[model samples]
Target: MNRVDLLTRSDALARPASIAVDDVSVTYPNGFTAVRDASFELGPGTICALVGVNGSGKSTIFKAIMGFVTPSAGQVRLCGLPVDKAVSQNIVAYVPQSEDVDWNFPVLVEDVVMMGRYGHMNLFRIPSRKDRRKVDEALERVNMSAYRTRQIGELSGGQKKRVFLARALAQEGRIILLDEPFTGIDVTTESAIIDLLRELRDAGHLILVSTHNLGSVPDFCDQVVLLNRTVLAAGPTATTFTQENLERTFGGVLRNFELSGHALHEDDDARSLNVITDDERPLVFYGVKKGKKKPARDKAK
Candidate 1:
């Protein structure tokens, strides 16, 4: 190869990748189109949210990224590599929703987390000392060390979620995809999970979380990709997550409320209150009159 060509290739490799989907389209054999012209890109040191309603092709997009299903058009790339190559190299780790797992399966919690190490194991799939240590550290990080020997089916809903997260940690993948991680967990557990995700993001791990909980999106995610068969919006949360964009994405699915003046039981400062919710959690904004102040967001959701 010429010197110029070699230099160009080296420069590309030197740059860290941001997961990317370029004009991806996924059509099923049944003549149903799952995703269309959808695209988004976010690099490491970011926690992004993939927000959309059920049947909006979230799962299909995820399948495409994981190489479970190939997109009829376009492609998915992770860490500067194709999806298949990334998966094979264990550059990606997935924590599936509870519904996708068979909780009744006869497996201990530690054993389940240890499965994450299979990619790093030898052909025999036996756990080495390093693998065992990774599993133990993962469990401890998720505060599930005491439940390591317990059956997978015997834990609480939140605890089960933590175990899966532990498995992802053990895998030590740079890209983590979590599907509805907060669906059934309590507030405290959800907070803990978000904390862990933030730590991962600060450590240069890329995280993509698919969730319907709009209230929590702004808390941790700085970037967002709104999907509905195709991408409605993809950018920083501050701009892309506005009420107008969300209304376009959710349609009639969100409940919006606006209260002003006497309705708020206030002394009539003309400040208004706005609430947008999907019933799970709501985003609330308190208004300000004149130029005295800008609107303030309450984090109750």
Candidate 2:
């Protein structure tokens, strides 16, 4: 058996990136303004949620970062390098939304993952033993090793997402951009993805996930960028991802359901459990007494 060769993680994603989007704006040829005056900064070792609804300029922001579309104004920097330079260096990996992919296209799961390594390959784009090893390792990391031989279209929705995630991991880019990763997946699969993202964050990768899954934002994300046509708020999850900010960005009230602590058999601490949701699912949080000092910490804390 040939010994496996791999790109050392220290060399691939050696250090965290300081990502900054300062006063950016994107305008299409049709005189359409996707986003205007949007600004947000994210640190390394953090998972930032780009929160918005449909047509809220999430894709525009992503395109700007990847250098796919030049911003009409402002700058996007990755680790102090310009977007184009960063892209040329393969310092970023993007997992586009499922809707952008053709599931009917015939491709093996492993081959799909191998696409991630194309940037690192020579002009011929032939897979070396090291490239093959990276693909295998990435598949194994996403628990998709058993499906390596399966056709991409034959897998479940959640499995397809995992395969793409593995592709990004194989690329070993220091910065990852995920667009609606949890959209069609179940709670279990979503939770698993979040866990993996947390692991990546701890490993010094900077992750930007564009998601409207408000219920799960506080569960794992370290930072939040609230956007509509422009950035409404941006900062730590606990502070910036608040009810008021969400309402302001989404242009609606966050439906809430309250369950008394007594209902859960907590007589001493009879605080009511408030479930905040954007018609997704219940996001659990316990409210403090109006006169008290916010109870030191809550679930999201």
Candidate 3:
């Protein structure tokens, strides 16, 4: 892994986690059940990889954790409280899949990151010195300080991903959730993100990231959760992410490399790729081009 010497949030590092999904089941409005009675415990200072095939409820679970979708059964808790409560406390940060973002909306890098501090501010209050400091620190952490003034629409796929990560950092959240963060990034950006995630983990943050890169689990994540509507297996990477569990989770479609421990091969199945490229999910051009304003509700999702 590449070395990433980045800014640290001591306050965020000192927090504890009670982020757990207890027998959670989510059924959409159309009577489609995405997740079924899934349960897992995520502790502080640990990076847990959420692995599954497409439409396997990974995103649904993330939404439940972020209080976007109310679970039909069971609940998601953070710091021993409900998700909304934890969010009100500004202790949770969520970075949605890049495919869900509308990048054409004109905005500066720093301005975009500053949106993370909205929960911390009172109504109509302007950004304070501390908020600016946090934004600066966050940009530096993601190695995007040089592009702080650049237009959000002018960034590469990898750079856009990094900007969103910087926003999460500026939030100073203890429990961070990322949905398919590596879907459309270059190798260098991927390495940098992995390094930054490790730095955050060592600094006492809890990270739950959904990814298709099984090879990276053993190397960076302390825990792995395999899901296919339910929790097939979840625990330490060494024990829970075995070939047997992967096959069970993927329904025997996962090909295992003999020499690569815990590394599942990506078969020709396009569904397994589950990749959304820039072309597939193009940015929408709307609204008057501007620098920044209070981000809209559900903007992160």
Best by TM-score: 1
Badly placed stretches (over 4 Å) of model 1 are: 1-17, 265-270, 288-301
What TM-score would every model get versus the actual structure?
Answer: 0.90, 0.87, 0.81
lDDT of 1 by residue, 133-202 (tens): 8888888888999999999999999999999999998887778899999998898999999998897777
Question: Scored by CA lDDT, what does every candidate get?
Answer: 0.85, 0.82, 0.77
Query: Please, what are the lDDT tens digits per residue for candidate 3 over residues 38-125?
Result: 9999888899999887877888988899998999999999988899889898888888777787778888999899999898888995
Candidate 1 — worst ten consecutive residues by lDDT sum? 2-11
Ranking by TM-score: 1, 2, 3
Report the Cα lDDT for residue 4, model 2.
21
The Cα RMSD in angstroms, rounded to one decimal, for candidate 2 relative to the true structure is 4.0
Error of 3 at 84 (Å): 0.9
Better of 2 and 3 by TM-score: 2
Error of 1 at 141 (Å): 0.8
Q: How many backbone clashes does candidate 3 have?
A: 0
